[model samples]
Target: MTLKKLASRAITEIGAVLDSALPHQVEVMAAPILNAKRIALYGVGREGLMMKSLAMRLFHLGLDAHVVGDMTTPPLGTGDMLIVSAGPGEFSTVSGLIDVAKTAGAATMCVTATPDGTVPQSVTHVVHLEAQTMANDQEGATSVLPMGSLFEAVQFLFFEMVILHLRDQMGLSANAMRANHTNLE
Candidate 1:
């Protein structure tokens, strides 16, 4: 396929996954975030990177957002939230962190392709993103993108939409979010 055709196919694949998402997914994910006094997020591999991107946007939206392993991530407790991605449904570390967050009286939200996965089943809430992940990417995968890329790509777009929703709900202007951007960068 030509480069442009390949790009178009990939975009279409990602869009199909996004379109499959439940209409309520965004609102379900955003509610705990808006209610949280602090929000910490985690994921593994490329999913982790996507989680970090969402964290940055959440911070820009004026929420107290942090990455789980960040040096300055404050401890989560009541009125706090832990958002995690487990595209295949479960990750050992993600599960452990969810346990910790729940024990601390915080809510946990999981974004995953398999909502029935162990980690997602354990979380306080789940946002299902139907896409190919490493778990089932080895054979007869639907996406032209390699293992787990579809999930990560769809995830990034989904998170951006969530950010936009939060921005509008909070009555935040783009300039307000920009003001929160790091000047040191």
Candidate 2:
């Protein structure tokens, strides 16, 4: 196949997979945070940055949300939600965080590319996206991109979509969210 054709095909496949996964993500993400006292999120590398964005949106939705290690994040208490993004589902740091989540008696959810992998069984919920390509560039002869790029892009896309869904589900106003934006920016 020509290089252009190969790249185009890769794009099509990734878009379709991410689109199909969106509904499942929206459906699952909504219910868990609805009644929680707060949502403490975790992820590592590129995935973790995406979680930060999601947490920011959650804060806009009038929920208490924070990145796991941030000073404002605080410890997860009973009736809280711990959300983590584990693209491969076996990251060492992710496993460690899940242990903390469980110990605190909080509900844990992992968004991963491997649902049946090690992290799935230990968590309360899983959003699985088995990606064929991701953003990590590497020196190889492969036509498609390297690991986790598509996954990371789609993770951000879907998380932004969740912001819209949360507004509808939880009755948040865009004006209110904007008001919450940092004035020091």
Q: Estimate each model's TM-score.
A: 0.97, 0.86
lDDT of each: 0.93, 0.80
Candidate 2 per-residue lDDT, tens place, 3-46, comes to 89978976876777677887877788778878789899988888
Judge candidate 2 against the unseen true structure and give its global Cα lDDT, from 0 to 1: 0.80
Residue 65 accuracy (lDDT) in model 2: 90
- Which regions in candidate 2 have their CA more than 4 angstroms from the true location? 1-11, 133-143
lDDT measured at residue 100 in model 1 versus the true structure, 0 to 100: 98
Q: Residue 71, candidate 1: how far off, in angstroms? A: 0.9
Candidate 1 stretches greater than 4 Å from native: none
Best by lDDT: 1
